[model samples]
Target: MNDQQNLMIKVVLDNWYSSVKRSDAIFNSLTDEQLLQEAAPGRNRGAYLMGHLTAVHDAMLPLLGLGESLHPELLEPYVKNADSKTDNHTPQQLRQFWSEVNEAVASKFNALTTDEWLQKHTSVSAEDFAKEPHRNRLNVLLSRFGHLEYHRGQVAFLKEKTD
Candidate 1:
């Protein structure tokens, strides 16, 4: 990759790191009971949002060709079903899972070269990737960044309900 491309990758990674840090802060601020409570009366609980983010991030491992997910059991409850329909984990378990998955992902991400980031993700067939080079590993990170921020906002609002 050229210097410009390397710089762009660094910028995106930095932003993603910052967002994850902010999310951790928001999540740590809430009590376990607070996490079980909904941010709004009829909305998903804070615990569900946390678990959902964890499961989604875990899935990205295989999607990005990093490795298999460490928490495959999370897929059915957290990803396949709505929060209302799925069984929620304890806040402690969710917190541990969240930390473990993100740490594993970050380690994998840090080891990747700029060229690797630009390589086609595992989900794309070679023919499709050749036609659409934009469907790369870095693009997955970008999309997941947006996903994390969206749920982070919802979880952050839980602080208000607790107060």
Candidate 2:
């Protein structure tokens, strides 16, 4: 890669890393009970938000050709019980879960290559790649970052309400 391209990739990765760190700090301030608490009547729990962040990271890894899966098992706990009128994680479990997932995501981000970052891949389902267009790796990465930020905001707002 050219120096400029390398620099750009570094910048992007660095920004993502910074954001994740800040989000993690915010999450760390909450008790496990708070982490699993629902923000509102129909909103997601804090654990669910963390799980969604982790799942998106896990899902996008293969698309980037990184050849590693992250937190596949934990995905269901975050997404499956939504709207079920029950909480899925205890406060302690939520804290540990977010910590583990956040660590995995940071590790993955650190290991990404410039070539991988620029590659294009289809986010098609098992049966749909032939019919769907490919998405750029950069776009996918940005989307995940944005997704994390979106959930972070929700969690932060919930923290305020709960506090």
Candidate 1 per-residue lDDT, tens place, 33-65, comes to 888888678888888898899999999999999
- Per lDDT, the best of the predicted structures is 1
Regions more than 4 Å wrong, model 2: 80-85, 122-134, 161-163
TM-score of each: 0.95, 0.77
Candidate 1 similarity to native, TM-score: 0.95
| Residue clash pairs of candidate 2 | 32-91, 33-91
How much is 150 displaced in model 2, in angstroms? 0.7
The per-residue C-alpha lDDT of model 1 at residue 90 equals: 84
lDDT of 2: 0.69
Candidate 2 TM-score, true structure as reference:
0.77
